[model samples]
Target: MNRENAPSTLAADYARAVDDRQFSAMETLMWPEFTQQGPGFSAESRTVFIANLAVLRSFDSTFHLLGQVAGEWQGDQYRGETYCVASHFFQRDGRSLCMDMGIRYQDVIEVRGGEARYLSRDLNVVWQDEREITAPILG
Candidate 1:
């Protein structure tokens, strides 16, 4: 694949990794020097991104309310944003509560050797804050 097309490949792989929940595979999709930072996230390096899956899985296992690419575009470099939604259940007090949000997955990525890889990403949770006083209303 040409160098220009590499970015798309990387983006596609990332989508696959998320869909399959292949934590290990997802690890290979990012560069070692990746530094992720944003308003609410401060993840640096690939290990930090992939390692958190275990803990997340212990609490939430299903990705619900998923949709299409939503939006896609590239700039001078291999940088773009993809908006996606995943309704996941959060475990609280031995109960499962579902939360849905329209997330803007801002990613700084690169393509090398025909494979696209992530350098940094900020999962901009466009909605919802910590479930502090936000208790789920149930009977």
Candidate 2:
């Protein structure tokens, strides 16, 4: 991909990997020193990041990339932002629940040897909703 399109492409691929729960593939897209900082979370390495993803997967979730908000190339580095929507579905005590959120990712990516790797990302939650889909049973 050309320099102008690389960031968006990488972001899209990463979003797809998350949605598919393909942690292995996600590993290839990150730098060895990859880090992510979010509203109330931080991961300083790919291993920890992937492990955090595993926790999210436990809820049975789906992520959708709404769009790439903006992007720019600076030297060998690219900065971009993307909007996303996610839904987490789970059952507790036989009651179904869901948590949905609107999020934005501010990413810094670097191109090395013609491959793009995510150097860092800051995730911000724009909105959220939590609801119970089934009433709790009472004995």
Candidate 3:
């Protein structure tokens, strides 16, 4: 793809990597110095970030729906914003519950060896909701 579309694709790929529990993919998507900041959470280095992802294993499933994504070249890096609705599913007392978080990711990326990867990402949670699931979850 073109350079202009690389950031958006990278954002979506990150969501998939997280949701699918493919932590190894992060090595290719993030720089070694990658850092992540989120609500009450912060990690330095891609290795630390990948290790921190173990928390996601506590959930039964997760789905991150990527929304608007836009970026612009800034000197030697690209700055972008990615909107996402992240849903976390789990069972509590034999009832299914879901927690949905409206997240905005402020990202910074730099291309290395003609491949773009994240240098840093800050996750902002604009809103959140939690409710019981009434419909059956289908695969």
Using lDDT as the measure, the top candidate is: 3
- Give the TM-scores of the predictions, in the order they appear: 0.65, 0.85, 0.94
Q: What's the CA error at residue 135 for candidate 1, in Å?
A: 18
lDDT comparing candidate 2 with the true structure? 0.81
Clashes (backbone N, CA, C under 3 Å), per candidate, total: 1, 0, 0
Deviation of model 3 at 73, angstroms:
0.5
Task: Tell me how candidate 3 scores on lDDT.
Answer: 0.91
Question: How high a TM-score does candidate 2 get?
Answer: 0.85
Give the per-residue lDDT of model 1 (tens digit) for 43-92: 67777767765645654444534333332335434666666665556678
Q: Which candidate is the best by TM-score?
A: 3
Model 1 per-residue lDDT at 115:
54
Arranged by lDDT with the best first, the candidates are 3, 2, 1
The per-model lDDT (C-alpha) reads 0.62, 0.81, 0.91
At residue 40, candidate 1 shows an lDDT of 56
RMSD over all Cα atoms, model 1: 5.7
